[model samples]
Target: MPIQPGETIPSMKLTQGTPDGPRETSIDELFGGKTVVLFGVPGAFTPTCSARHLPGFVEHADALKAKGADVVACMAVNDAFVLDAWAKSQGVGDKIVMLADGAAELTKALGLELDLTARGLGVRCQRFALVAKDRKVAHIGVEAPGAFEVSRAEAVLGAL
Candidate 1:
């Protein structure tokens, strides 16, 4: 089943590229005892993801933080290097945490994995955003396929 509001995120390790190097972070380590805004995209550098999905969050990171979000992050089914590059290209590297779900482990665990093999993309994550506090999801906004409505920063911020 898909993860629902109030469900505690499963323990999983994700890769985040930092100036020091690639770091491994667990759900507990990232969201435990913190209010977090986590948004997931199908892939890094994809058209919609690069243009609207990510930029929306990037442009509103400070506003979301001011609304009580301790951390604002973006996750995609790509390697750390690609995610890092995309973050830099978007000019939001410092504002949003770019996480790489190299193996789709986190996406599958959340039941948000979408099979796009016909498009040669293989498995990808659905576009969604979650407001989490202390490792439990407080609110979830899942976008419909090919739609960009709920997961935008303004939408999630309003929920907060």
Candidate 2:
């Protein structure tokens, strides 16, 4: 089952591409003692993800922080290098933290893995967003296939 509200974020290491290089961080390190809004995409630089999903968060990042979010993060199954490049292309800068779940370890831990092997995309994370406070989930929005309503940044802001 997918991770639900009130469940603790599982202990899983995820890589974040930083100016200094790739840094490996655990779930607790990211979400502990913080109000985090984490949104996941199937892959970085994809059509919908690049056009709307990510840009929304980038635009509303300050609003989220104003609403009490300490961290706004974006995660994908792509590698740290690819994520870093994409972040640059999007001009993400320090507005959002880009996480690379190269092996889908964190995605699987959250039970949000989407199988796309037949399409040659391999396994990817489903489109979703969650609000986690102090390492525990307070709200979750898992988008239905081909739909983008609930997981949008606006929705998460409203949830907060």
Candidate 3:
């Protein structure tokens, strides 16, 4: 089963890009003492991920923050370079934090790993959105494969 409400985010490090290069950060450091909206994508720059999923959060970031979310972040199974490039391509800037779960460790820890080897995508994180308050999950929306209803930004903001 995937991570559920009331459960704390798993303690695993994820990489993020910076001027100095890639920096590894743990879940606690990202979510602890903060109300954060973390959304995961199968891959950065992919169709739905780039076209809709990620953009939704970026568009609604201020609304989410006004609703009490401290940070709005986007996570993917790609490396820091790829994520950083995608963020730039999308003009994300400071609107959202781009997280790189390159090793799938955090996805596996959350029980949300999706096997896409059949499609030549290899292992990936499922499409999902979560509200973590002080490192604990408060709301979660996981979409079925190829679906985008529940994990959209509007739904997550409504939950908040």
In the range 9-125, model 3's lDDT, one tens digit per residue, is: 877788986545688887788898999999999999899999999889989999999999999998889999999889888889888988999889899899889999999999999
Kindly list the per-residue Cα lDDT of model 2 for residues 25-121, writing each as its tens digit.
Answer: 9888889899999999999989999999999999999999999999999999999999999999988999999999999999999999999999999
Top candidate on lDDT is: 2
The true-structure Cα RMSD of candidate 3 reads 0.9
lDDT of 2 at 97: 94
- Alpha-carbon lDDT, every model: 0.91, 0.95, 0.91
Residue 79 deviation, candidate 3, in Å?
0.2
In model 1, where is the ten-residue run with the lowest total lDDT?
Answer: 17-26
lDDT of 1 by residue, 121-140 (tens): 99999999999999899999
Candidate 2 global lDDT: 0.95
Top-TM-score structure, candidate number: 2
